[model samples]
Target: MDISTDVWGQLALEASQVYLTEGGQVRSPFASTTIEKLPDKVLLNIFSYLTHREICRMATVCRRWRMVAYDTKLWTHVSLRPEISGLHVSSLESLLALISIRFGPSLRYIELPIELITHTVLHELAAKCPNLTHMLLDFSTAMQLHDFSEMQAFPTKLRYLCICLSEVIFMEGFMRKIYNFINGLEILHLIGTYEKVEEEEEEIYEVINVHKLKSATPNLRVINLYGINFVDDSHIDAFSSNCIQLECLAVNFCNKVTGSTMKTLFQRSRRLTCLLMNGCSLRSDYVMQVEWEKSSVQELDLTATDLSTECLIDMLTRIPNLRFLSAGQINGFNDSVLKAWVEAGTARNLVALDVDSSDNLSDEALHRFLSRHGSQLHGLVLGGMPHITDQLWQSVLQLLNNANDGRYYEIVKANFERADRTTVVRTSTNCRVSNYYLLSNYNDLIFN
Candidate 1:
């Protein structure tokens, strides 16, 4: 007889009784027997599915549960970010106390708000969390740092550091202070918030010297400087010359970066695979003149650039192993570009393509390209195309569905109601295909 359903209610009641009891004393003999049968490993595995708050609540269930719930593995990666952990800003002290008592040396990764990263806190983290290697500090609140010298106490073992700053005045000084501590850092991502000014003049951003960074972190492999206005061709040239093992470099929205830097990277950085330069001033002449012995670049994003049709086609021919290509908001991107890609066999290796806001493309060109490369493509974004009607979308969906061995593909659209409204559609598959339609002035979709 199957007793699974029959005993569930009774077991649940017994479990509740065990939790409510002062010392977690089991009221029923059956409950004690059942609870004892589950080993510590199994209990820990079960607790892994729960949130940090839920895990803390589970500790009240019984002594065995308390032991399992507080397992070091479950607390290795901790997020103190209020948005993610559902933690309040005022509860930071209590959270720090909990981390000191529970996480201790086991915390390998942590995400903290800038407000909580004080001099004392840094020293405490450095002393207590000896094994901590990855840290992400969110400064989106535009918190001001009193002293950069305090960062000398930051954990030295950190290999991955991501900081999100919002027009902070001491950006350069803050980076320099931490540079002394994180010499072994492999990945550094600096994300800056850019506020648009109504005037015609551009807002000047605080520049961090890339040459100094290159000297400090010699073994750097991945660097992403998003919306940092100071990045230019000199910075890219510095990385290309020094950081030989660099794999991925993204300087998206740094309008100062022109195609000259891209040309430098393509020719010098052989191991580079992903290069994102969206919202830069990439001139047609500079791009057309790019010559490389053999570019290892596979993923490239040139969204909102000034590249003409001929230059784009020529650039595509250079990167033979290209898999992901995003050329959104290019006026010169038309049916001829798609036709050229298909003709040159460049569309064969493409797994994802984003041609959003390219007004000149028609249904015929898209349908033709998809018909040939639909099987290989797992992601396709075609937003803001007036030519692609609802009927065309349905036909494309049908074509994609039929191409993938009769597998059903559904479109999930999420509409955000704001000044800049966005509608995103994704497919329900192992691979996600996102098509973001912006009903606002912003032309480029920010991909996280």
Candidate 2:
């Protein structure tokens, strides 16, 4: 009595149905009636991944989710969208009312586009979000005609602040208002918002002392001035004296800053860790040779500065602890100079080296350096280096293949390197990475 395959399958299905009927009444609840038992902790972790807008939408899902979302910890990050409805209203009262109702006391961090943040709303947020530690306010246009004195009355808990006050008129009292308040600041980024049109030189100079940040935020550790036009070096001197603990200093498009003044200011801050001078027309041969505290500086970014190999050697030798070096457009190094740096192992401890568009580097020089240091290198951002032709990538693969004989090495190459390397690789000409991590990796590239 052998059963056919079809007959056996039918019998098994029938048996399963009979067993289900006899054992459990075979009643399937509606799909909506059943509640899935997902762990609350897992849900919370998922919620953390959502953006502020996404979180706001999720809050309206159900009572339980809404209550959970209302948790103060979850609202610590608030990203205000400029395109959101009811944001463009010029009236402060209506805007405040909407914000207060939608978001309670849970706001800790707020990022607003310059156009959307009304002066009154900014003051109201300052008063409401006492626990605020980070605030990024981008105002790409002229400062509105409103009083910011109310900001002084708000909490001074901000530690990280990035404000683009370019073109904004700062009255005489503005400096006092900021100095009296925002004393707890540690990181300050004051970028001047300048338009292409030429304005009165006096007005440009007038904007300089508008908000004397050095006097206000004495505890500042980092200060970056972008699009800032200063007639003299007095502001830098003031900052050097006041922000004595400064670690990172960036001066971009400050054509008025003399090389001597910059070098002198660099000597003032003992804790200066990173210095960036981009788009400056300093043609001095000795600018790069200026000595700095080697162990203190971990990062140096000199993009679009007119520097030659002579300057490069000066910088490399002086800053021994430099792990990251972005010498963008600093041409003039030939194979000999590169060979010298490689032989001296100046970049042995570096993590990232971005010498893009530099005319000095040659294919042979790059090949020799990567061949020696590629094993320890994690990130290599050498774009626009004329030497990085197809032949150079072949050299890279050959070099890595030679190094991978039982030993371990991790290397991430950018657009310059070929994709066939056996080592763990990430390639791009403009490799996007965090500023801190880039510095750290470069430090490792040099030191490791």
Candidate 3:
């Protein structure tokens, strides 16, 4: 895909005094009229590209500018985060108050830190922004409040949620209420509650029923959970029964989820296209014995998980439509796997790969893998293989060079070419790390 013009438009507006450059006409190098003389539509277009902080700063310029800056389209998608460490609560309250008045009713997507999940603020949000769809909470801060009965009070149309709460909080009627109320929720991202509770509370902490959560979100297509430990056999069964439309299931560091649950998910969710499991102790037998479904999984990520060689090959063998594969350090994920992949002709169809930090993989194996698969690859990550030399990196570069030939890939190719020139040799790794991948802008495509 082309580097979106929207992204370029934002960057240009931020750094340059831009104009409509759609024609061959070239105007004077300087402007005769001030920004105040610009039309409202033009000003709105510029304001739409700015972030909340920049808009706030721009609003302080002049009354005419401030009036123009308040366009509803410009404030629809609001993203806020802490600017500095140890911020005072009063500053946050003041900011929220300002946002309520300034952005009122037009908001669609809001991403904020966990510190801002206040009841009053959420209630205000629910009242004002009824059309909100996505809300992401950065889980760096410990959430102090519970009672997200307030979430029902946040936004009725809120379908995408990313929150990291303690398991105790999940048990205490937050998720159940959310699932019950927000039936339209398609994406529920739980950023694993890995933070330890007080020593006293850990002893008494009890597990809650996750089946209720599954029952509540029947329409869910994506459930990405991190550091979660509550998912079990019952939860899996509930999901299998209820969430048939689910396409993406990502569980990272969730030790409680067994391989049997995974197999059930694979068998049941017919539309399931992506399976991402990281740091889970999934048994090889249950994982390898997955039965077929209508929607063949196209993306598989086993990074940082305990996957053996036999299980890995079996999964690849069974899942025929896989175009993306991300794996971490697995023993015997060297020439043997590469040979099997190439021989099976599975290597030719792959679109992306992220096999970082393999201790045993040689340059010859990667060469064969890439020669077979490189034509189709849009993204690749081979960082930390000890055997790959400088000459081998060049060979790998030559192998995927054809990926640069197309209108959609021009900007990507340019960026890659620029990186090749601007690269400073790093002695630590013995090669510029950027050599491992093209289209750095497409990192998200590698796993999703």
The numbered model that scores best in TM-score is 1
True-structure lDDT of candidate 2: 0.61
**Model 1 lDDT, full chain set:** 0.72
Which consecutive 10 residues in model 1 have the weakest lDDT in total?
436-445
Residue 335 lDDT in candidate 2: 64
- The TM-score, computed over Cα atoms with residue i paired to residue i, of candidate 2 is 0.75
Task: List residue ranges in candidate 1 displaced over 4 A.
Answer: 1-38, 60-65, 86-96, 148-152, 195-203, 389-448
In the range 317-375, model 3's lDDT, one tens digit per residue, is 66667777777566646677777777776555577787777776787888888877787
Count of clashes in candidate 3: 1
* Candidate 2, 1-448: lDDT as tens digits: 5467787665556545522465666633332232224556666777888765666678898887876665566667665544542123355575587456645566766766655555567667766776777776665555554565554454468887776664646545444555566888887777765344565565454454623667778888777776676533556677887887888776667666556566666677878777766666566554753566334777777777766667666667666666767766666655666677776667777766666665667777788888887766555655544446656765675555433453333333333254454543454544433233555323211100
Task: Highest lDDT: give the candidate number.
Answer: 1
What residue runs in model 2 are displaced by over 4 Å at the alpha carbon?
1-44, 60-65, 83-91, 98-105, 113-123, 149-152, 194-211, 229-233, 285-289, 293-295, 397-436, 440-448
lDDT of 2 at 368: 84
In the range 1-448, model 1's lDDT, one tens digit per residue, is 5687768876778655633376765565455566569789888888898888788799998887888887888988777776766345465577667668877999998887877766666777888899998888777675576565655578999878887766645567767767778888878877777444566765665545678878888777788878876777788888788888788888888787887766777777778877788888788887777663277777778989888898887878666778788888998888888888888886667777888777898878888888788767766776656456555555676556422344333332221111131222243333323432211101222222
Clashes of each: 0, 18, 1
TM-score of each: 0.78, 0.75, 0.76
